[model samples]
Target: MSAEIWTGVRERVLALAESPGVEKVFGFPYGGTPLEDPLTEEELADLERYCGVRLPDEYRDFLLHVGAGGAGPTYGVFPVRRDADGAWQWHGDGGDMTLPKRLAEPFRQHVNPEELDALLADQPDEEAYEDIDDYDTANDAWEERLFATLWSDDHTVGAICLCHLGCAQRQWLVVSGPERGRMWDDARCDYVDLEPLGVTFAQWYLNWLTEAEKTAGTVSPSETR
Candidate 1:
């Protein structure tokens, strides 16, 4: 993730975005316009301060050197956005994932299904409820909390949606904690599991680009898994 490596990544990504064949494959409209410029240092700083954490080094290099958005990968890399409340969030629409407050915390590398089971253990099982309606009411509340914990923004929490892989799938970059600088493929739609890709942002970006170069238009969301 050296600056030199990122400089090379920036050039290759820029080249790919500008390539005519890429346009034919991904079909993302650029309106025959050029890519945007790198984000200002001040802008990056303000984002970090608002999020209460520094971005991973490779990603920081990317936004500072590479274009802020509009290039690379399947659906193209998404730009960072701030809402009126100054909350840092990304709404890819292709896949909607939150940028959580715990993004500043060290990320969790893996999620344990057993942990969720433990949470359910805190509540009485359906058998514990004599009345079916009562059981439904109690379980609904617990189920809501269960889903929230599963998707929380701490360790094992998703950081950012780096790109939309299409078909309601996404490639996420880990920003907080143990997985802090790695890439993950979220391919739950095909009954496939969430899979890890490269360890850093640079590697992940290059891997996607390389895939596209080798076989244009063959790239799909499931490929990342």
Candidate 2:
């Protein structure tokens, strides 16, 4: 689907989530779209067959609830609503769900920019080793280390899935961990470091979505399903 379609779906989903009777909402930055074919049992089976990976139960339930919407190629969905107490609720079909332990922990601690800088600066200057692929090469050792550190300490950060976009030279961070995930380009990165936007995951998602809308323009209602 086009960018316009995803925007409209996102707005609708957010509205539903904030409406009464809704508890909470969640979404992904990328993967599938509202315009794409609704996920079916056969499709799920086919995906597993082709991908050779068994999706986690929580993720499966998430897909069943919110098919796909947002900026990325495939994403989760949710509706935003207010609770009786006047607090906001991120309501979705899937009830309280837990993310994998491996993916949680980073959000508990602040991302240490000093540590990341030190790690990145200490890397040895050398050619790529055959044993380690490009991602594992010393050049990216610091980034991986930072990500691993965040992943191990906080469960919230772990929920945000990481994916490389475009070519090696130009890539972006896609944060799809908790409520209303979105793709974060370089600008969003700035916001994460400066603003008090909740947890790292929430800040990242909101920053990315806000920037994406500015860059891509708003989606019209007619484009939504």
Candidate 3:
């Protein structure tokens, strides 16, 4: 069933690639409609072993059947590659956030609203500081501390940063706990909490593909010529 689903997906991707003026689509400069090669079973096994957890079923199947990653939602999926020493790692902007060692742990979904509110409320007030230089120093320090707390890895355990959406935005795929197999929007870089997209890997990817095609259709045919 997974293979069949991937086949249909590949077909859609191909169609999208063949669309007129595909080069003008958003994120085309980065991905160019090319998918990386699929991973072998041995490679997939090694990746799972290294992470100490089995990947979600649909994603695992995608790595096995479809290309490992490429030309996906937004800027495209981050591609996993092996080094000269045969160590596997995902490569792309913001990919480092996916801690493989923590993949087996349950994703921590509980964010303390009170704590977050308090942190925001603690922002340094420029009006309170009489000296301009002193206000700058205090503001910078406050921002540093606030960002550190909000971007802590404790909030994203058991997940992988799947793709970057530019402007410091990204998405994650949970591999363990109740949210396993679902996608989450990572807007923490914008000081927002992560929100579950409420869609599985396949659904998320396919939806993007559909939207991409629709975007392509909106281009005037004369423009391509």
Candidate 4:
């Protein structure tokens, strides 16, 4: 999509933030409608280079024309910024989960529910151990193995954590492989397999915007399609 697609999106979001009862939105209070400055071409290039993956087209354009992040779905999109040391990093709650180095790798496209169930079932139980120390050791090992099997960086390759939905749940935007450009739900923290949201980055953001506007009474029902 052209940069024009993002034109006025920032203003539209600002409008939503100011609309009546915007605070009633689930994450509006925490986000407070803060919007970062849009990235320049140089900054966008640097981000893509550092991440080793080109962002989804819609997201890339949003970064260029709208804002790098801020005032988005849930608690708002995680913002990427250059630190004092001039290294680009995404900053927000759960933002560290987005491993920049792993963006080049292809994202795992499939999840086996039975295998996940089996893994959860195999969790070490303290009562099964004869001694507390044994239980601690065994539990640690099991936890490590569990993370390696399902929650490792390898499992989330080519995806970036975009927003958190309270608790430990977060949303990811796939940046590589066949699923590139789609959003995925990360419920592995709850021992659930990842699932697609069946929406592209733009669609996801726009849907949230429409809902937010409606909640704020800024959009009439007839205006939405």
Q: What is the C-alpha local distance difference test score of each model?
A: 0.65, 0.36, 0.81, 0.81
Ranking by TM-score: 4, 3, 1, 2
User: Candidate 2, residues 1-225: lDDT per residue as tens digits?
Assistant: 122223343454444334442222223333334222335676556544432334444333333343422332213333223346543222332212223223323223345768656755666555545554653666676656655644343424323232222231111122233322332221123222212224332333344544444344443244454
Q: Which candidate is the best by TM-score?
A: 4
Write model 3 residue lDDT over 1-225, tens digit each, in one string. 656667656545655677785776554325344777789999999999888999998998888877788888888888887778876677888888888888999996656778777888999899999999999999999888777777878888899998988889999999999999999998877777889998999899877776777778743232345
Residue-wise C-alpha lDDT for candidate 4, range 54-111, written one tens digit per residue: 8888999999987888888888899988777766777777888888878889888545
Q: Compute the lDDT for candidate 3.
A: 0.81
Find the 10 residues in a row with the least total lDDT in model 1: 215-224
Using lDDT, give the best candidate's number: 4
Q: Distance from true position, residue 87, model 2, in Å?
A: 33
TM-score of 3: 0.87
For every model shown, what is its TM-score relative to the native structure? 0.68, 0.30, 0.87, 0.89
Order of candidate numbers by lDDT, starting with the best: 4, 3, 1, 2
* Residue 95, candidate 2: alpha-carbon lDDT: 11
